[model samples]
Target: MKKKIRIKKALQYFGVPAVIDSIKAQYFGGSELFSIKLDYLEHPLSLRLLGSDVPTFKKIFIEQEYDFHTNIPPKVIVDAGANVGFTSVYLANKFPECKIISIEPEAENFEVLKLNTKPYKNIVAIQAALWNENKKINLVDPGKGSWGFTAEDSDDNDADLIDAVTVDYLLEHYKLGHIDILKIDIEGSEKEVFDDTSKWLSNVNSIVIELHERMKQGCNRSFYTGTPGFNVEWQKGENVFIARDEEVMSPR
Candidate 1:
């Protein structure tokens, strides 16, 4: 497994040929806060000025073969945990007329997220964490990059408090009666969001989530149990694609 991951990493870095991307890393090709341009994409995208995030980019941009296909391109897409807005940008370009709502909690990442999606008028950016409520939550760093900032209830005094809202709140405020595509990568908080998802699960047409049971043990169960209405459309590595059998099964 380690060997395969390393091989894929090599392919994404040197093999994919971002030969023109400017780099100012701590060490050349070493993972310590390097800026990279994904000009190779339909819309050019760049990483945030944060340390050690290249691998996360590589995993989504290179290794994760998540083809955003639908019978008709998604009309409403919600990107939870939208770090740096790469996925949101891709969605916007792929679905030009679709409305995109992106949420990110980390200050540095949210700044870059806005910058990357600035050209797209269809995208709406939010700088709040999505929890099960509309309250302040402390973020815990899982340490490689801003990708692992989990919204958890805590009181360490030193930790910073940021605003959080439920998925239901997002749907209600956005007036999204039915979400065409709901992409969630909120680290390990799938447990919290899916705990009482009776209100929103039925309205979601398709869902692509990166479950963190490997990092937080009961996440897979939480997601699966909560989403009893959707079928496991497909899965690769840690990510799972789910949708209603009758409505969204045709898209895949």
Candidate 2:
């Protein structure tokens, strides 16, 4: 069943035209990546196919995550696991006044994230894993670049250690009194973050997360259980929306 779903997802990722373009790009070998300039936001973005062309505009702009109808624009937005910085760019355009900090852990993905968000001065791209602790940890590279990076407890000693930061650290480091919107899609490390939302949840008004229980067991449970005061709604897709005030949802 999982194999079948993966096949369908791969088909969707390629569709018809992308497959042809991907093949051409492979042979030409001029640039490994492609640039996309969005007309709506006037934001330039770069895309690499290793699950990094990850469509997020639909959820950000179309779905309206940080948008508050009450005319209270978001002050600060934190984007965890901001793959390639598309989502951070989207948030930057959507809330021009808001300061966005885009965090991506993978080396290759972090490089791309920096490039894509560089044009926007408001977006600060950081290379750090959002985990429970501040210590370094082993990161499992599933080869799917943006989509499948996972954190594992290993004692290999020679294993590459990635710098990590906790939610508590972010609040203190950024001097963020309160996070207007916190979008977490940290692949599977969310289990570690949600392990304790007590220190962070009070300061966050809106929360948009993409849970991956299949990737890390109890991801859904951890988020659901940890955030007791917030209103949690599981959307149609792999994402979930939780808020302290009025619930946010897709208008369409």
Candidate 3:
């Protein structure tokens, strides 16, 4: 399964034409419900990212409307595990006034993330892992199995590691008083990020997270309750929406 997924990803990364060719070649007569094809370019500003072109788990999150319970239109957004920075760019464009801070740990991915957000001045891209503590730790590369980063002791593939910081530390360091919307999609490390972020949750107005139920390091499903904001719906998708309860805005 891992090999097959990797091959598919490789073909998709190649281009839209390669993706179409691979699908037709493999399935022949079968029909796929939907698919996204990214058109990567050599130029930084020319790079385009959207649900129509990029096959990512955050597509659903982008389509959904926030349940607004306050007058605040999300002046600040924290995007953890920004991947290629599509979501950060999207939010920045959607809310021009909002300040977006995207956190990504992988070296290669972080470069792409920075490039993708280069056109937007409101977005700040950081190349580091968000952890429970403000210290550096070794990371595990699961080849093609999962893009999720974990502690080195969790896996023994490569001996590479990087520095990390806590959410509270980031808020304090950046002088961000309250977060309007916080989106976390750090593969499987959502548990630790949330567990160690109790000090900052009270000020967060809205949250959308991608929960991994089946993880070797125990899923972080338990930490969802401590948050004070609104209790939104949950579906079997990449990310789930949890809005603030004070002002419930019906989905348009």
For 1-252, candidate 3 gives per-residue lDDT tens digits of: 212323444344455664565456445644322334333322232122221223453352334332233454677889987776767766775677889989888886677677678878888898878777877767666653225565432223344667677778778888888787788776667667765456887778777777776654555555564564566645435557677663522233
Q: Between prediction 1 and prediction 3, which has the larger lDDT?
A: 1
Span of ten consecutive residues with least summed lDDT in model 3: 42-51
Which candidate do you rate higher for lDDT, 2 or 3?
A: 2
- The residue-by-residue lDDT of candidate 1 on 85-157, one tens digit each, is 8778877876789999999999988988887788789999999887877888898776645677788875455
RMSD (Cα, Å) of model 1: 4.9
Report the number of backbone clashes for model 1: 2
| Winning model by lDDT | 1
> Stretches of candidate 3 above 4 Å error?
1-54, 57-71, 151-159, 246-252
TM-score for candidate 1, please give it. Answer: 0.81
The pairs that clash in candidate 1 are 33-51, 33-52
Candidate 2 at residue 222, lDDT?
Answer: 90
Superposed Cα deviation of residue 68, candidate 1 (Å): 3.7
Task: Please report, as a residue range, the 10-residue window in candidate 2 with the lowest summed lDDT.
Answer: 1-10
Angstrom error of the Cα, residue 45, model 1: value is: 1.4
lDDT of 3 at 141: 65
Q: Work out candidate 3's RMSD over C-alphas.
A: 7.2
Question: What shift in Å separates residue 170 of candidate 3 from its native position after superposition?
Answer: 1.5
